[model samples]
Target chain A: MTAVRPFRPRSGFHADQRAGRLFAAYLVSLLLHGLLLFALAGGWPGHAARSDKPPVYYVDLVHKPVLDPQAGRPEPRTPDTPVPAPPEKAPVRAAVPAGPAAAGSTDRRVAAALEKLRDERALQEKFAAMRQAQAVPKETPVGLSDARGTEAGVGTLAYVQAAIQQNWALSPYLLADPRKAAGVEAWVRVTYSRNGRLERFSFEMESKDAQFNESIKRALVKSQQLPQPLPERLEEVRVVFNLKAMKDLAGLR
Target chain B: MELITNAGLVVKLVLLILAYFSVTSWAIIIYKTLVIQRATRDSARFLDFFWARRRFDVIAQGLDDFRHSPLAVLFRDVHQELLQNRRAADGGGEGLDADLGEQDRVARVLRRATTSETHRLEKYLAFLATTGSAAPFIGLFGTVWGIMDAFHGIGKSGSASLAVVAPGISEALVATAIGLVAAIPAVIAYNHFVNKVNVLIGEMDNFCQEMLNVVQRLPRSRQER
Candidate 1:
């Protein structure tokens, strides 16, 4: 072959070289941007792969004291149920008569006496009834617990108990948060027959966290028979307890 | 593995193919845009240089510098024809009556040059048209296959729950989305490139007529020489 000649740059060669470099840089930058986009959105598929759960809320029910009917009677009130002072009371009126002064006065006094006696008798009867009602057996019903008992059905309680026993078998990630442990509370309400066997058992209220509520619901569901049957005549029963003990027992904590 | 084994797999495969097509089409679009833009700029520059120069010899030298350009090629062909006619007239060897024949020869040469220039300008455009027209259908085919797979899965699973059906349908729909992704840009690029090519062709036609007019106006002896 002939000897190689030294090369010289042609006109526009530098412009062509610059254009090529710019094009290459553009391509490289586009590639890097696409990769960055992919990196950012790539986790979405995995996130979507996870299962969905429901939300839970706190609820409770408490019994109020019965009111005394006789306390409001229009009579000489006792210290426990005293009448208000004049500033707090409505205006009063004087009596009218239809006979001679002596006879009318006597008759008005008798009517007042009878009215007072009637009011006293009514108050005594109300107190006696309230006393009798209070005398009734006040026992917690079997399979009955706190506010959760009203919210959840008997089947839901059994389900919760079973789930708790199974260590919340649905997913390991369900109770991974420690905050959820404190939130998991069980409310059991029981309506017992005279023999104390569970007539109706329910999970009244659940934890605000969905996973915790589901676990509680599952636990109650699994424990069909209560530890002991309730006594007869206990019409209703309720119990509210945090789920931390149950979770610890189940080794889920 | 057969593509039709499951509709979902088929759909995913189709989407993947469509993605490939989209990527390739975008690359082509970018490349073609750059090429067409450069052609337009360079051709405009060459035309301006050709017209601005008063001397035919200077214009011819400039055309030589842009020998790679379609417009330059057209100009060179016209200039050659004009030079041949001038040479023949300067020689005065044969019929002064043959001036009409020389003009006809020049016209033929110009027509041939126009055809060549047009062909060069239209190069690779057919591929772009084909891509634009067919990409959408390809993507749709993928989507249809995917949906069929999703239904088949639902039938096999024996459950028509939203949880089960939604995921499968969503996955299958990805194919159709990819198809649209591939097709939209291709169609847009095709239209844009076609319009550009048409404009360039119009310019070429106008330039050819203008060159012809200038050639025809030359002094007979000067043109021949």
Candidate 2:
């Protein structure tokens, strides 16, 4: 009998053969992929492909807007003075005809309406109070606390006072004694032309201290001119200089 | 190509992975084609030879010509088991119980051979399956990442115009295109190869039964000798 060979599976040999085929196919596949990539790189869509790069738009940022938000529109104007609110009218009583059945509906409606009117009146009063609170009173400049005259005269006197105060100064050494200078007051009748020039000044009530009087006169002289033209009116005005008031204006205790 | 080159880092990585899948699957596709074609052709020829010869020893000598045939390899293995049984009987081990034992042993050999042949036919198919199922999602991940990056760029630039938004989106979509390119062929090839493998397995089943019938006739022939 012919000798039968030992049984051995050819799995290893078959595996090696399959591996070789796989590698060969890999090489072929790699070539095909390379060719495909080359075609894509060459711009595969013919002339339709966007070969030229997209346009690079440069932008600049600015704090102010470039485009006018209100272009082609009219410029809005604000009124120099606020418009006043319309005056409130008195509430008219709604008439009710006679009878209890009609009176009940009317009475209930009147009560509701009266309640609504009260709420509205209260709101209006509250709003008026708020407006009054918001409204600031006109204040005369400080150091003119006792100056009295017409509106134009007071305005002119205030201007004169301001000019004098700008130049007003007295050294402590000029006072003979601090306690003696305490009650000193000087009254001067100052004259000014309508063109805003201080014409002359004479003391109506002179202080006991001569240096104090001289200082007040010197302040008037150094003023040179009123800061602004006064309105044409009675030309002369009185200015009183009280030591306490002067001290207070100077912020001294 | 410009689109691929200009893609974001994550997108580039996704495209690279998809390219690898595409290339490797193509290689597998080619290799499986060659292997299954040869296997089917050789199995047909081997079966024809087996039926014409009707001689196990002669068939054994000719197994080399049909090495790619899973059926041929199965026959060779069972022929070896039959030879072992014959040698045992010639050495004075033959009895009624021993004959039954030989049949059991032969049956075991038949089962083992069928399993090995089935495994051989189904090899390298899982890679194709994985590529088909996973490649698209991986590409989608890349696309989402790229679009997120684009929106992040828009946030930094403070621009939502089409000029600013279009290029990044275009570059992002390249990943999905590559993914679809990779997955489509793989899925189609996977389905086709699965069908082919099933057909081959069916043939192996039929071949296994035929082999069992031939192996069962062996002991009677030996007893007559």
Candidate 3:
């Protein structure tokens, strides 16, 4: 409680400065926010429309190795003793590579060189059959590049594969990831009568990818029935889903 | 598709709230800056004008320019009190301006004026403090909620991949980022405005004492013409 206090004066500028400054700042912030929104909407990276990249799928046909059934017990070498053997006489490969060696591998690099030649003489005989078959109404088999090269067990395989290829539709979800899609390997064994009426079907090989696996199943189901009548000798057809052929059918890549 | 539309409802709501906080906080900052700046400038001018001339009539006549300054309000109140006290004292012809009680009364009047002016300067500062401290936490809550929803989506979708969860997480994080955006400036402005208010309050207090000192030396009563 001091007795008397001295008297002085001060400026009044701070009295209500907050209100005006706050109003202005609020306005400025809103304006700036609006401008930012406009900029974002206008695609500020030079105003180009932000078009989504269509996921490109480079479909590669992976040919599973055709295991030599003549494996484990090597046939007695016909006196062509193994050493750095002459390239002209390399053993057991270029034979009836399926017997017909149908598509004489138009692009050698794309053809996985798993073919072993027994002798050029045998290759000449199969090549003649392959050329004759190609001259007929040609049908490309789905799983393996050329089914005519096989012995006599692929007419129904060819028909079923063509049917599934025609029916398989790639889902857009699967289209987002082609790498994942390619790994989806599933096999369906269809039991059919000689008249080609499908009696039953079950997955023989199920790849873990559910969506891609489902697409393969859906394709077979969509086909419903094969195009041509099956031979009486063929009671069932086990078809390995060729995703590459499916991609070709779906026109995805 | 725009990422925001894909964001879960909780995240969207949180973003909306953060946006509101940002807009409001900016408003406060802008308003506070303008007010404090004007107050400082005009109040300083008023104080300088006051000290140079040391005249009630001259400065009081020009209180309009310093309307936002706490000091002006202080000066006006004190000046009015002093004039009233002086008029009362003149009729009594007591101990003049040197009278201890009269001096004490003027000091009391000044103390009161300073208290009220200081009060005025402190207005809206609590709002600033609240925004500065709470906004970030509010934003964090939104982020947490958004992440929770995102994880829930993954659980429902049965996909634990990054692509599945990334968009949701990004959307949720936006709330936290915006919260910080709103809070940072609010905190800066609040501290600054508080400091300015304190300086203005100090000036008003100094002014009260100076006003008393000047009045103490004045003649107790006007002589007969």
Which candidate leads the pack in TM-score? 2
Tens digit of lDDT per residue, candidate 2, span A68-125?
Answer: 1211112122253233364465576757586977888888888898788788778877
lDDT (10s digit) by residue, model 3, range B1-225: 265666677777877777787777776676667667877887888878778766677777888877877777877776665665555555654433445676786677678767766766676778778878988888899889889988988999999999988988888887788788878888898888899898888787787777777777766552110
- Native contact fraction (fnat) of model 2: 0.40
Candidate 1 residues lying further than 4 Å off, grouped into runs, are A1-107, A113-253, B1-9, B63-69, B80-109, B220-225
Clashing pairs in 2: none
TM-score of each: 0.48, 0.53, 0.50
Which ten-residue region of model 2 chain B has the weakest summed lDDT?
Answer: B216-225
Top model by lDDT, which number? 2
Model 2 lDDT tens row, B1-225:
788898889999999999999999999898899889988898899989989988777877788888788888777767766666676566755533354665686677767777877777777789999999999999989999999999999999999999999999898888888898999999999999999989988998898887777666665565223
Model with the higher DockQ, candidate 2 or 3: 3
Query: Model 1 over residues A14-65: C-alpha lDDT tens digits?
Result: 1222356346645754675466446555444654355334467633222111
What is the C-alpha interface RMSD of model 1?
A: 12.0
lDDT of 1 by residue, B1-225 (tens): 122233465676775676566666666676667667876887788888977885677787666466445566676766665664555555664433344765576666667776766665565566656666776787777767666777888899999999978766666666666667667777888889889878878887887787767776876655433
Model 2's TM-score against the true structure: 0.53
DockQ of each: 0.02, 0.17, 0.22
Q: What is the C-alpha lDDT of each candidate?
A: 0.57, 0.73, 0.66
